[model samples]
Target: MDEAARRHNEKMKRIKAARDRMMQDKTEEKGLIIVHTGAGKGKSSSGFGMIMRCIAHRMPCAVVQFIKGTWQTGERQLLEEKFADECRFFVSGEGFTWETQDRDRDIAAARHGWELAKAQIRDPAIRFVLLDEINIALRYDYLDIEEVVDVLLTEKPPMTHVCLTGRNAKQELIEAADLVTEMSLIKHPFRDGIKAQQGVEF
Candidate 1:
């Protein structure tokens, strides 16, 4: 082999050895509390990806949408149509907080969504639960953080993974989650006077 190719192979060999050692130490499996937050987009999109993963494995799942209420989303429609028997979907908001401008009404809707989420979390048969946009509800004080954390840590099924997605996730939630991903905004179409398009933004 050429000198350059021999060096490249040696580098890859070391990388593989290190990766194998890391993998060997990760033998335990348990349900995860995943959080997707920050100002960028794709928070909910990532949560939906996890839902698809669970569905592909034939694992029961549930979704509780706390904001974006009744607004048509392609992922919701696809899940409802293709995996109706395995997924329970709920929408409990009346659009954005600015649209409603009613604190009491927003609180009521958040509570309703939380009730549905709790039900899903308690269901042993449900292997995954997606609390879509729930971070925004928590950020607005529509739901009590302590109560939400308490139930998630104590009452959720041992093998049930849960995902909470939205901007401005609370520090408490991030500290409790097993995995956290923050989407940073580098560039967006909206800043360039582009409108949200079907299949891309929705």
Candidate 2:
């Protein structure tokens, strides 16, 4: 064997040994609070991907959209068409806050969405719950952040993995999450005069 190939093989062996050792003491298994936030896209998209993972495992899952309107999306369509038996989906927002322009209505919608989210979270049969765009509601003060965080952190079923996805997630929720991912926006086509097109934004 060449000297470079031999050195590479030895390097991989050492890395694998170190990784195995690092994994030895990580034996605990439980539900996780996952947060996806920041200025970039894909927060809700990532949450939906996790829901697909749940479906692959034959686990019951629920999706509650707190601020997304009734527009159609590919993920929502696939979930409703093929995975109806394993996933429960809910759309609880009329549109964006600016589009609604009514504080009372927005608050009421957010609260109603929170109620549905809590039901799914409290259901022992459900292994995963996606509260999509809930942080946007919280950011606008449309829902009570304390109540939402309390239920998510304490009242959710022990084995249920709950994911909160949106931009500008509250600090309290960030502190409570077991895994937190912030999608940083380095560049976006929207700034380049490109509009959101089918199969891309929706």
The candidate that achieves the highest lDDT relative to the unseen native structure: 1
As a whole number from 0 to 100, the lDDT of residue 57 in candidate 1 is: 89
Clashing pairs in 1: none
TM-scores for all candidates: the values are 0.98, 0.97
Clashing pairs in 2: none
lDDT of 1 by residue, 91-198 (tens): 999898899989999999999999999999999999999999999999999999999999989998888999999999999999889999999999898988999899
Candidate 2 lDDT, 126-152, residue by residue in tens? 999999999999998888788888998
Report lDDT per candidate. 0.92, 0.90
Instruction: Name the best candidate (by TM-score).
Output: 1
Worst 10 residues of 1 by lDDT: 68-77
Off by over 4 Å in 1: none
